[model samples]
Target: MVFDRLIHPFCICSFSLTVSRTKSESGVPEVPVPADDTPEVLNKALSGLSSRWKNWWVRGILTPAMISFFFIIIYLGPMVLMMIVLCIQIKCFHEIITIGYSVYHSYHLPWFRTLSWYFLLCVNYFFYGETVTDYFFTLVQREEPLRILSKYHRFISFALYLTGFCMFVLSLVKKHYRLQFYMFGWTHVTLLIVVTQSHLIIHNLFEGMIWFIVPISCVICNDIMAYMFGFFFGRTPLIKLSPKKTWEGFIGGFFATIVFGILLSYVMSGYRFFVCPVEFNNDSNSFTVDCKPSELFQLQDYGLPPVLQSITGWTIVKLYPFQIHSIALSAFASIMGPFGGFFASGFKRAFKIKDFANTIPGHGGIMDRFDCQYLMATFVNVYIASFIRGPNPSKVIQQLLALRPDQQLHIFNSLKAHLTEKGLLPLLEEAA
Candidate 1:
């Protein structure tokens, strides 16, 4: 409350200017109508079809093109993929915040737009700073300014956020107090959803492109397969929020995704490029995907269960352990992932809007397409941390390298003693 006094009379003009920059809105928010911008030939081709059939055709045509572009981005390498992710994150934040502005337009709250963008900048700074420090340690340590920034990154982020928080409190007007706080909460929630999840996605990417590609591909596969099955075979509705979803489609999509995930994992697991964790190469001054393949990526003989062995007359099966893990990823993608979309649908219904924005013709917006993806990203990141990932030796070695020479020598001697007691030092020396 004390901070409210900081909005002196001198600041009113500039704050008013910022508020005026927000798009004009009527008292009532209008539901967005998705634009029909398909090619004329496509429209002509689909002219005879029913609306449902037309939608299916449009999505079918565009989906492959989107997938092709996705693969092109992948081929462009991780940096481009990361930049694209940031772009999407920014677009998604803009779309959600714009919707909030539309809904709260009657109050004409001050500093809403300016503070929203300011908070976006603050969160991006925090997350990207953490990422650079974690993944590019060598580069950060080489530069004095970067090392200091990395060292005090969290404090800087918190201080920057406090500045924005104080500004919001100061800009609040009496009549619009409630509405101002509502938009403030709305902005923070949007940042949590879009920026935070996309950052996890980048983390998964650094683990290995396989970790990134497989989970995303499973989600995409389930979405498309579910739609296809529901179009033809769906009978009983699955949920109230999503009218078109059906039990048949849900069941069909689950099986299809599991199979697709297994096959994809099997193919990807064999390639070092897909399985190796991304690392910064101090020598080449670049990122590298070169490393020894982990046991998870290697094929091994696994004995079948007694029932399966009896039925198939085989006792052993050769598979990548990653293929087994794929089932869990695909299961979540099929079974739990749709709930993210349902939540989004509920959010839209509450706001009396049809979609977040009409960025795509058949699809509603980037948010519409990615609602489940953000959820999936969070799950995959958790799964890797909880079950798949072990302590990274490279990270440990890097930390060791950063120590004082005496500290490094002490650690070396201690490790040598431990290894000698464990009887591994002799074996290691013999191999060397």
Candidate 2:
């Protein structure tokens, strides 16, 4: 469907080129030059944009259909979202492979026929990560979600995932393509997991959507800031790969992401200081008899660690471990977000394209929009793991919850001790 829909526009543009070439060859005996093409190109783009601004005839016909789909997904919730995403993934992958084949001439995809394409999209309609099936079985068994999934067991997960991979491969065979077995095959799998996992992460892991919102807000705010600064103040080019990307825009975007990231994260995590603990707290205050460390982050009148801890009535003994996360998060945002953008620029240059796809009016493709957040999220997830564990032991999040209650409490105490040693307080303890 993607190829079919895209091909229409591409073919139209191709036809225009053909007519121009023929006219030049037959009538004028002149070849088209870059300079001569600008007027016609601008006219075409303007015409295209104007045509896309449809009248009420089209708008009225489409509005209800659009609302229906929106309501079905938004009102129906995550299950619907998963089904929609699964369908999109299959379509996007199919389009990607088809385009690759046409562009590269590596193989002729026999299964790229319209029917075969629709068949895979239909399969998604039947299978939505076994979510409905599992729910039905769980309802029958009267089990909670965690228990229900556990009942299926690790072997079940392996078998199901393996089967899905097989089907995925089978779908590609008709497209007359094989996935890049080592690199892209794994990357494809990772993307699927990441895209699908966000729903679960927002729902179950974090207990709310807010936990994941910081990264998105930070990336978007940085993008806005970059464009604003670049357009208005950019003077020095940041890189030859992206000459339009100015140092002014780059630095502006960097600081914006860091500041916004820390601020957004503080909103999500309830920390007053918009930085990780490693950075210095610039203010100082008095810790009175009524105040405690729990409210250390309930910052006011500019206070220091000692003053805030005493004010909050927290044992001045344990403020260090808690302070580092904010500092780390802020620093990482400044570094990681810009790196993500640079990576995107590199990818675009490799493809010899200015943007991934002209899907957005001012921006690029869906992937282009999300790429920075994808990088930042992965960075934060990894950083949270290593920072929480330190050198003595490496504890990933998967292991954190499995620890016995007593072990969990012990680890908490160790964290407190570590923070106290560092001369800062943990956010949770400060909040408490």
Candidate 3:
């Protein structure tokens, strides 16, 4: 009977009151109890939740594989990569337009979106776009490849963007608002994708992949340091823009990046890693191997001077591979990268959302993935432009400057010479 009474909810309440009264009557203060087995019940519930969180990453192999696939599309260099990003940009643009309109209350017109490529292209020229011919000559000295690639990219990207816009418009006509919004979001997406891809192509064309590697390495180091520290030592909030961020984590992570920069500069550059590596030589002929200079670079033969020795190892063996080449240069990207991330975070928060699409499971959406990268690319591009002008631009200025001296006389003589040699100038004179 006691056991049955203890099991009943109402009976338990009654029994608790009787116990409290008995204790009070006996001159003892009543001890408070929350309910029957409250602590144990809460503990069990918490345990179950913890288990789920601990094992959350035990997904199938496709999860990691899908992640790798996406990574390749972004970093695998031009050719196919340009196309992949074009598609992504179109998708992102649609998302942006939709999110702007319904959620963030941003205004955008249908016609503007439909003609966004042409619109932006015109604006691009005004902002800084130039003759693709001149732009390439400025970078590579020879503009042939650059010129061909430029025309090719312009035609393809514009066509694809226009096609996407038409699709969006058609979806609206068919009453498919779901896809209509998607197509709209795609335009913004395409902007980021195309911009990043183009920057990479240009980077490879100018200083080769080496110039671009700095941004990639630095971003990787920064992100890794931030996440590792945040996961382990996060306490105080780092910024209002991002609630989950921590000051301790950010500081710790940044310090780690500094260390990585220094370490890479020394280790990867083939310079001193504590003590610089000594050179060894083996000449094919009679040699002064013992008299060889103590240096980092190896000689082709045992007798060759260390200074004249062939570089036998990685080229950047003397400086930190991760160090920023230009301090004032990287500052823009450094500042912009975090700002971009904060903006994206703010966007997601505004919509009362957690993650974006869960494409990476742990990482969030494609926008989340690209937030920092997009800003970084833009910043770097601007930095390069500020420092380096194209050959065509340089040559054009040179040509115009040279014309100021004896300009008409030089042209008249050149025309006379051409007519004397080719006879075209005389034929034109006879016709006139």
RMSD of each: 6.7, 14.5, 19.2
Residue runs of model 3 more than 4 Å from their true location after superposition: 1-88, 98-206, 262-336, 387-432
Q: Against the true structure, whose lDDT is highest? A: 1
lDDT of 2 by residue, 232-257 (tens): 79999987766777889878877776
What TM-score should be assigned to candidate 2? 0.49
User: Highest TM-score, which number?
Assistant: 1
Considering only N, C-alpha and C atoms within 3 Å, which residue pairs clash in candidate 1?
Answer: none
**lDDT score for residue 21 of model 1:** 39
Error of 1 at 54 (Å): 1.0
Better of 2 and 3 by lDDT: 3
Ranking, lDDT, top scorer first: 1, 3, 2
Worst 10 residues of 3 by lDDT: 272-281
In model 2, what is the error at residue 380, expressed in angstroms?
2.1
For all candidates, the clash counts are: 0, 32, 28
lDDT of 3 by residue, 250-327 (tens): 777666666655554333333221122111123332211122222322222233345544655333233332233333
TM-score of each: 0.88, 0.49, 0.48
lDDT tens per residue, model 1, 311-412: 999999999999999999999999999999999999987766778987876787899999999999999999999998888775686689879999999999
- Candidate 3, TM-score vs. the true structure? 0.48
